[model samples]
Target: MDHLAFDDFPDGLIVAGPDGRVTYVNERVRKLARAEGDEMIGMPLAEAMPFDDLNGHTWMECVRPYDGLNTRSAILEQSWYSPRGSEYLITASLKRDRPGGRVQQVVIGIRSARVRNRHDRERSDLVATVAHELRSPLTGIKGFTSTLLTKWDRFTDEQRQFMLETVDAEADRLTRLIIDLLDAARIDSGRLTLKRGPVRLDELTERVLRSISAAGSEPSWRMDIGAVQTVWGDEDRLVQVFTNLAENAMRHGHGLRRVEVVEAEREGVHGVRVRMCDRGPGIPPEARQRVFSRFWRSGPGAGSGLGMYIVGGIVTQHGGLVDIDDAAGGGAQIDVWLPVNEPEALRDGDDRGSVIGSGTTRG
Candidate 1:
């Protein structure tokens, strides 16, 4: 095999001689260990990439070559904890030149378990959160439909219509929840596709506000459109951002006085800004920074915790930024800063951007 190819391998690689002396290491090993030069080449395997067993003995001693005649090869997976508190999945394979021959070398492959474990936990938490979120709407639809079907003759027209409306609303909620899961998957895979175009921020805000009104949500919304209303972005995505923010305001704002959206420009900033402010219980100081994190919830009845994350992702895709702060009068304020002009790179899809998934995960 070409040795140079190993340098490009996705995982770290280390080749040790039969006597357990480091002979070669790929670029990944150098990067993972933050090593330089030939410092790691002549060192013992454990010395270069240290690992201690439960008994405090070197990992090398625990997996040392077996003496029996039939013991020809061995493979094991172990967790390697770095001095810097990083974790790696270490897969070590000891191979003999031929069956029953002397153990020639041990090939070790290392990958960052920290990133993998984090993603796994997030996925697991998402599945659980989705299941919990789906139960309420599904139960509502089923219970109402069952009751209506059994008591068709006993119900008044008004009662029947009310139940049917409830079912419809619950169904819509389920659809939104499912769409969010799909979008999350797409975002994770980095396959989020955006249809870039010129979007009017003020018009989009009005449309979303009208949507909230039509939904029968009782919240006063105030809009302020500044000089620059149009931006280069995906129209549908921009609409989604507005919709989520409006809904979030309705759900979280207590004694909800009103939702105010303002689009303006700052003196030194290069982009147009949109601020969504509500006169309700504002976010706490510490929780402000984590509102946009996936599966993060600061309080009960907070939607699936995916709303702000999705909002963050979409704004970032447009090369914009979203931040949370206290509204002027004791409420939560979310500020979205978007560039008036789209960068040539973003328009051409040449820049790497994160995908924004929608749906609520409020508890």
Candidate 2:
């Protein structure tokens, strides 16, 4: 094995002894520590590389022997300040190895995480502030529109009809924007709450299908519900999940005529696997990795990038996994996996639950 190759690795790497003393520091590690070549090699692990976690834990304290393995490991995020009064975020992982029956050899890898965290935090703050500012005006508009519609008999027929149509269109637009803002806020705060409950999968799928049909947008849409009777989850959130998937399929499915929802149990866990397959030009392989990212859209005509982001967040909050893959015959398929043991209480109206857990749909 070429030790030099390891030294040149992208992540910082350091080796420590059983006594928790640094024995070797790779080039990357030395550079990150801003230390001389020999300074880090002989010092105690804590003193040679001092770092503290966001929650105030020392770096060494967090890396324990890996559970059930001779090696211990941990990934830690810590902040460091430069002599010039600037701060940097560092993410480091330590792994203890027992190679050749030696238990004392510990390797630590470190990298910069400050820029990423800062960017994410800033974006979240912006979303929250924008959502808050927009809510009051949206509410006012919707309220006045409702009042006018209710007072329809007081106006002439022509005036009443025109007002009603204008109000209806404006209300719809406001509602969509509000929903987007809410989703953005929930995702930014990581506070979406889930009201989990035991739900019949068959009934839930049927309800979503009927609701989408009643909306009368996609008359040619088709849904296939599986035989799985019960799944543990928030029914409303789950509906939002499917609704987003179905809508995305309809909108981006390139004139997709039919949508399908399939259910099954796998490996003893009841799973409701909903696949929204469309006939549109399928997502390119290069962009598949980002399909679920926030504010990500495929092209100019694609809808707001928030839909898939909301879908991913909702499924994840339920302890389920969601992904986009190539459909069996054509188009992109959004597959969602929900655990059967998802709590029934998550479906209740507990607004304070985890923001990620609240399955709210966004347009």
Candidate 3:
């Protein structure tokens, strides 16, 4: 491999000789470690740099070469601090190489954990504020409405009916908002739980279609249920995933002529792959990576922007991967790849009654 190509690698790369001296540091490493101007080559690995891992270990300790070539690789978590003293956690992998019988090289790849941590913190704060603001009013409305129903016999029929309707509408709004909050919280904390079981995916799709249809939307929907019959996941969270995708299409599929949800199975490492596609104006290439990020909205005042975030989180919690790509006919397609086998049992005890919503996913 050309040495210059290492500079373009997305992750930071550092190549050190067997003597524990730096031979080459990639552009990414230079930028991240703030080592500019003079080449890092020829400097002792430990003496030339000052960096600490997330566990407060020295960079040298974290990146020490292992005994075997290509067989021993380890992940190191490091912390990088900003000028203002905010810290970021980074995870890097160190790989050992021995080539030409005379050279031993160690390559390091670095990724910033701080960016993800900061985004997570901001999302949590936002969800908390929204939930707190909405909870009080919802509680009062529900409480007063319950009181009225208790004394319904004293009120005229029309008065009672009106009160009931008001209560129902408020309750519905509160329920929807609360669900959104819960989802936001679950996603932010990386604690979203999945109850994996054999699921009839087509049945789930049809059920979601019927539910969406009942809501009185005119958008044309086409679904292709291929030979795939079963998936392993929490049925309810899977429903939430599809429902959020459909809701996103309804909200953003404005300019498109039709929206379609297709289901099919493709051979995957762990199992089969299930996908969902939409006909909304295709997401721009630049924004595709961040589409699943929390509170990421494309256009001005477009949405709360947590729909796809929740979808990604729920799918991920199930040990699955989700992605956005261009639709065949012009739109954005969201595909989710789930393992057929159940993932490792969740660490948190099985407690299924928790509700999911915008800012939080539980009580």
Best by TM-score, which number? 1
Model 2 lDDT tens row, 1-363: 246778778767777777778888888777766887688767887775566544566555554433234433544555654333345554543444434343545566566666677888978976775565467556656765777768856878787667667767667766775687687679769988877667765556667766766777655645554444356677887777777776776667764444444455667766666666778778887887687776677765565567777777888888778767787777777667776564445435353122111222212
- Model 3 per-residue lDDT tens digits across residues 104-143: 5556555566678888898698767576657755876877
Give a tens-digit lDDT track for model 1, residues 1-363.
Answer: 366889899999988877777889898889877889777897777676676543466556666643445464655677766666667787777778788788788788888787889989987987888889899899999999999999999999999999999999999989988887777666667777789876767567667787787788754655555454357788898888878887777777752344333344555655667677876788888987788777687666877777777788888888788888888867888888887676566556644232222221111
Model 3 TM-score is 0.51
Q: In model 3, which regions exceed 4 Å deviation?
A: 1-167, 255-267, 270-274, 298-303, 342-363
Candidates by lDDT, descending order: 1, 3, 2
Give the worst 10-residue stretch by lDDT in candidate 1.
Answer: 354-363
Separate clash counts for every candidate: 9, 25, 16
Off by over 4 Å in 2: 1-160, 255-262, 266-268, 342-363
User: lDDT (0-100) at residue 14 of candidate 1?
Assistant: 89
Better of 1 and 3 by TM-score: 1
lDDT for each candidate structure: 0.74, 0.64, 0.64
What's the TM-score of every candidate structure?
0.66, 0.54, 0.51
Residue 363 of model 2 has an lDDT of 22
- Give residue 341's lDDT in candidate 2 (0 to 100): 66
